[model samples]
Each structure stands twice: as structure tokens, then as C-alpha cells.
Target: MMEFRSVQGSLIEAEAARNRARETRMRRALQRILTAAEGVPGYAPMNWSDVAEVAREALDADRPAGSNR
Candidate 1:
């Protein structure tokens, strides 16, 4: 037999964790993008929106097909 228990915390905690993980992944992706960009000829400066778009694409590409996340 097994027992399940709940710890007291805001329901928002799970969402906060997910957001933190996503931010970490985005940061890593941004670092990789910047590193790769450094080697490109005539590389242009990247704005936050551009970086965000690329990061979102990278994150989406990492997800398995048919996943809602």
C-alpha cells in the first residue's frame, strides 16, 4: 500500500518553477546563439525581441511533436 500527501504552498509554485526552468533554458539558448553569431561574417546586433524569437524557436524545436508545451 502507498500513501500520498500534499505539502502546503501556493498553487502558483508549479507555474513559477516552470517559468524559472524556461528562463534558464532561454538564457542558455541565448548564450549559444551569441557564441555562434560571433563567428558569422557581417553579423548584425540582436535586439531582445530577436533573441526572444530565436530562443522560443529553439525551445519549440526541442519539444516532441504533438506536445502542447
Candidate 2:
């Protein structure tokens, strides 16, 4: 239900738009990493809960209140 218009400008413009979106995404990721490194607290410090549990318990040592461990 559409028409095919093979104008060269349209293709170039589309490529440019895609590149802009990619750059915006990259910039956002960089900003988030910087903020979390600065300890803004918006980011969770741990990843992969199951994998980190051993390390967490080793470092924390103290069990949280009412923990069933």
C-alpha cells in the first residue's frame, strides 16, 4: 500500500537519520556509566544476582535482618 520513489537524497537522508540515532544512544550510555561511577545511586552496583551472591556474602559478612540464610 505504498509507492517506491528511488530518489538518491531520500536514501542518504535515511542513512544520516540512522547514524544520528546510533550516536545519541552511545552518548547516553557513556553518560550513564559516568554518573554511576560518580556514585549517584540511580544505578544498581551489582549485576547478575546469582553470580554475585557469593562475592556479596563474602564481602558483607553480616546477614541482613530476618534473612533465612
Clashes of each: 0, 0
For model 1 the local lDDT of residue 68 reads 96
What is residue 26's positional error in candidate 1, in angstroms?
A: 0.7
Q: TM-scores of all models? A: 0.48, 0.52
Hey, what RMSD does candidate 2 come out at? Answer: 15.0
Worst 10 residues of 1 by lDDT: 1-10
1-69 per-residue lDDT for model 1 (tens digits): 122223334446776887788788788887767865675656566677777777788689557699996
In candidate 1, stretches whose alpha carbon ends up further than 4 angstroms from where it belongs are 1-10, 40-57, 61-69
lDDT of candidate 2 vs native? 0.57
Clashes by residue pair, model 2: none
Model 1 lDDT at residue 4: 25
Report the Cα RMSD per candidate: 6.7, 15.0
